[model samples]
Target: MNRNKSLFYFAAFFAMVIYGISTTIIGAILPQLIDKFRLTGYSAGTVASIMPLGITIGSIIFGPIVDRFGYKLLMFVASITVITGLYGLSSTSSVDILRISVLLIGAGNGIINGTANSLVSDISGEKKKSRLSLLHAFYGIGALGLPFMLSVFSSVVSIREVFLIISISLFLLALLLVFITFPVAKKNMGLPLSEILKLINNPLLLLFAFFLFFQSGMEGVAGTWITTLIQKTRIDNYNSALAALFFLILALTIGRFLISFLLKHFTRFRLLQVGLIIVISGAVIIFSINNYYTTITGLVLMGFGFAGGFPIILSFVGDNYQSISGTAFSLIFVIALSGSMIMNIIAGVISDTFGIQYISILIIACVFIMFFLLYNLNSKMSMK
Candidate 1:
């Protein structure tokens, strides 16, 4: 049993690794993509924005399927999707094909993300909160590592080669998933309409989902625009954008690990409030300042702030709705991805008109919006 758990955990780790790569890969290669494709700002934004659309679709679909059929199939299929997507990205020249590739890749990543979190929650029992935090910290590790990998190898290898190598690596990961036995799915043959209605109407669930919407939106903007913001502000020192991106991802990694310790003493709500304060401060600093160093600092601050919310909220979902946790998670994630999509799509349009600078201002507004949701969620959870 212990050995099986270890294998499952490794499977979960690589699952997140795939997601991390997919999540950051576009941002890492964006400049190169633009030069190679000769795309306009609007075209670039369109390409970038479509990824979340695919992710939202995958998130919406994976829940009930994973609940009924188990994680093995979905995870296997997701890995293959990521691999195929990368291959398409590596080989394609047409922006249309590029869009399709990234869409598939994003979908794959989202499925793995939702499935892995739900699986870890299922296995960890009462320790779901801390365990989920630790599991996702691997995601941060993967996300943080990829940009650096690209940075190091770019001089030696073409961007296409980089993605091709990643695709092969994912193939191995998919092959490995075949042999590891996963936890069995919940035995429900069908979801009742009444239960579906209850989930739809659950105020606490809606609040939690609403909170995540902003959470994901903030993350979407941070990941996609941080480099652009840095590049625009520091024309001569373009690499600093990558450096700042590094700091943001690293800070997120450290912050998630910090969450384990935080759970020991801090109530989840207090921790969440603290995270919000830091995120808001970062947003304000980035919006107000122009320096590259300040931008990095602001991003790192927001990183730590964004770290604690998802694990705690997902834990609440898992603990309360253990039987149908997959579907519940799916619902929340769909809402969250919609938030990301709305922000990215709007930010894309805004970027073409005003400037990427507005991205920070929008994130700041999102942080404040989350304040209201958190209060409502806190009130509800406290009563429960």
Candidate 2:
């Protein structure tokens, strides 16, 4: 039983690694895709947006399926879907096929990501925050690892070859899933309509969902635009700009591990409050400082600031809604992804019309809004 539990935890962590890789791969190889396909800015944006659409669609449906059917089938199928997508991406020449492949990857990742988090929450009991934080830390490993891998291998290997290698790895993971014994379905056959409505109408749930909204937005903007902002304000070199983005993710990854330890010493709410303060300070530094080192420092601080929100909030949701965790997670993820999409659009428009530097301003605004939401959420949670 102990061995089985360990395997379950390993599977969850492995799934998150896939999640991190699939989500970041497009960004890592976008330049190659653009060069190969001769894609225009508009076409590239359209292609990029399709992934999130796929993710949102996948997020909307995974909860009920997982709750009713259990983790094994959903995870296995999602793994296969992602593998097919990666293979398709490596082999396809047609842009139409490429888009479909991207969609598949996104959808598969959404299912895997949601299911893994829900599974951990169910298994961890009272240790959800620390466990989730550690789970997400693996995600950071994949997120940070892939680009570094690409950079190292780019000169020696073709991008298609890299995709094939990743696909092969995922195929092995899929096979491993077939042998692992997953926990049984939480709901027997179906979730009643009343339960669905109750989850939707729960004010505390909604509060947590919306708090994630701004949190996701802030993260989306920072991840998407920080490089551009760095280039516009502090550095002109592309590699240097990329390094700034790298540091942000690196800091985030490190911060998660740190938070996992720190949770033992502090309340999640107090940690969250401290994180917000750190985020505000980081945003100010980015907005006001012109030096490269200072900007990178600010990005690092922002990364650390951003690390605690999802794990902490999702743990709260998991703790409170254990019976229907899959559905609850689905709701929050869909809402959170919507926030990501909306904020990316806003940042793009603002960057185009005003200046790229305003991206920092937008991040600062979102963090403040998150802080407001977090305060209210704390009060509500306390009452509960």
Candidate 3:
């Protein structure tokens, strides 16, 4: 790769790391926030819910902007938004301010996440799936790092201090992005409304979007609830629960890294089918067994199982909608984030009404639905 492309790739990878950390930061600090703010369960859930809402809004708007304006300005501004969010989160005492901060973080990360994936897909040509998988491995690193940091440093430092440190690192990332060259806008004039409607109505796009719908839902649920489930069912210690969550993300990271290489040997469709099967198997393991090691094992399998879904499906979207990929991605992400938000809300309700252990059943159901969706999606692709 040339120097500019190499730098762009680095920027994309680093952006994903930021996305990863943003994703888990809420979960990592929830308990502390709850205690510090004296929040009720309902109030805490509201705070958790607001972030995805922000992400959804961000995903909805970014496609048109990136397609018309290129990535540098969007990424730079989004990074600054995230940095400000982090600063506010570290310093704020008011719940309203906290909510706003979370919203800023989520919205900023949403833009960065979508932009990074779209950027990588734009440049990766036929290797979009593999490259996207590799790119998301950095997300795993960021996801795992936050909880691990909390687990190790909670006793030594305040969570606020940790947030400040993370903000500093992100500020540096934002600065680096300013000097890097990026791909020009893919659709400088932007897609017409009629064209966007047609793309939205396209059957293949719908399939891919809903497939991601469940995919994002499953992931959001697992990422958000796994720590609580582990704590409630298997362990009483918070650190051990964080450890379980860490193992899950670690497995996901390793699986993505491996998938990047494995795609060279396996067809994307076939590998995705196998990954879905693994997800089902993992969900069953989590549902059937109660042992700590077994739960961890189940989480690992699910991590590996989930590793392929986004990269493969989003690659398909990119390949099919090359001219309006940013818009296409935005549509896909809007649907996907909707699924994430809805399912997370449902999971919260399930936790409140039926108990946390029952969450495994919801996960199992989602995996089965995803399996059905994948079959339909694959059949449709084959027909084409």
Candidate 4:
């Protein structure tokens, strides 16, 4: 690769790492925040839910800005936002401040996810899905690594101190990003509200958007509730539940690493269909039992199954709308996050009222829904 392309790929990988940390760090830090803020269940849930809203806002807003202005300035600002949010999180004892910090971090993550995916797709050209799959592997690494790092250092440094140190490292990374050159935006890429509205009204785009909706919702449900499901079902086995969760992420990381090779042998649509089937099978397995071996096996299956969804779907979007990919991605991401937020609330209700055991039923239903959405999405893309 040329220097620019190599640098862009590095940035893309870095962006995914940032996104992974932002996504998982909340669960890692939640107990600490609760202890510091004296949070009730409702308040804690509210705090958790509010971050997605910030993500949605960022997803909606970043595309046009990137399309108009390119990625450099936006990334610089986003990194700063994340650093500020982390510092705020470390410093704050107020419930409201903690929520705001989480929100800001989510927004930064949202921007990074959209920009990096679009940026990588733009740079990779024909290899969009393959490289995106590889890029997303770093997300798994970051997600899983944070907790591991905290575990390693928790004996010496507090979580708050760790957050502060991370903030400083990100500031340095942002400076490096400032010196790297990225792909230039198309001269005519910027869209007015009228054009953006028309773009959203496209039947194909809407189909993709809705597919991502269910996709993100399914993922959100699994990641958010899997530990709880394990704990509720197993009873007094928090360590095993935590281990199961780690296995899930490890499985996902391995699956992502494999995707680079898988894409060489399989078409994106075929892989997506296979992923859905695997997810369905895993869901079925998990729905039926409470054993660690069984649960971990199902999580691993689900991990490998769900791995192909984002890269494949996004490859189509980036392929079809090269000039406006950033904006196109924004639309789908916003819709996806919205769907995830809605499903999280519904899952909360179901788990709370009918017991957490019912969450398996919810997850299974989501998998089936994703299956159909994948079918429709594949059919639509094939037609193109």
lDDT (10s digit) by residue, model 2, range 1-384: 778889999999988987887877666665567678987544554566566666777788799999999889888889888888888888899999999998899888889889999999999877888999999988888777666666565578776777777788788889999999988898997789899899989989998999888887787677756655665578766556667777888888999999999999999999989998898888899888888999899989998998899999999999899999999999888888777667766776776677767778888888788888888998987887
Best by TM-score: 1
User: lDDT per residue, candidate 1, 1-384, as tens digits?
Assistant: 889888877888777866777788777666667778987667777777778888888898798898888988788898888888888888898888999998999898889899988888888887889988888788899898777876666578776777776778788888888898888878558577688788979998899899999999888878877777777765545466777888998999899999977898999989999999999999889989888888888999999999998888898899888989988999989998888778877777777788878888888889889999998888888899
Q: Global lDDT of each model?
A: 0.84, 0.82, 0.85, 0.77
Alpha-carbon TM-score of each model against the true structure? 0.96, 0.92, 0.95, 0.92
TM-score, structure 1 vs. true: 0.96
Per-residue alpha-carbon lDDT of candidate 4 for residues 51-152, written as tens digits (9 for 90 to 100): 677788889888998888888888888888888888888787677788789899888878888888888887887788789888889888877766666655
> Which one wins by lDDT: 1 or 3?
3
Q: With candidate 3 superimposed using the best TM-score fit, by how many Å does residue 363's alpha carbon deviate from the native?
A: 1.1
Worst 10 residues of 3 by lDDT: 39-48
In candidate 1, residue 206 scores what lDDT? 93
Task: Supply the global lDDT for candidate 1.
Answer: 0.84
Q: Which residue pairs collide, candidate 2? A: none
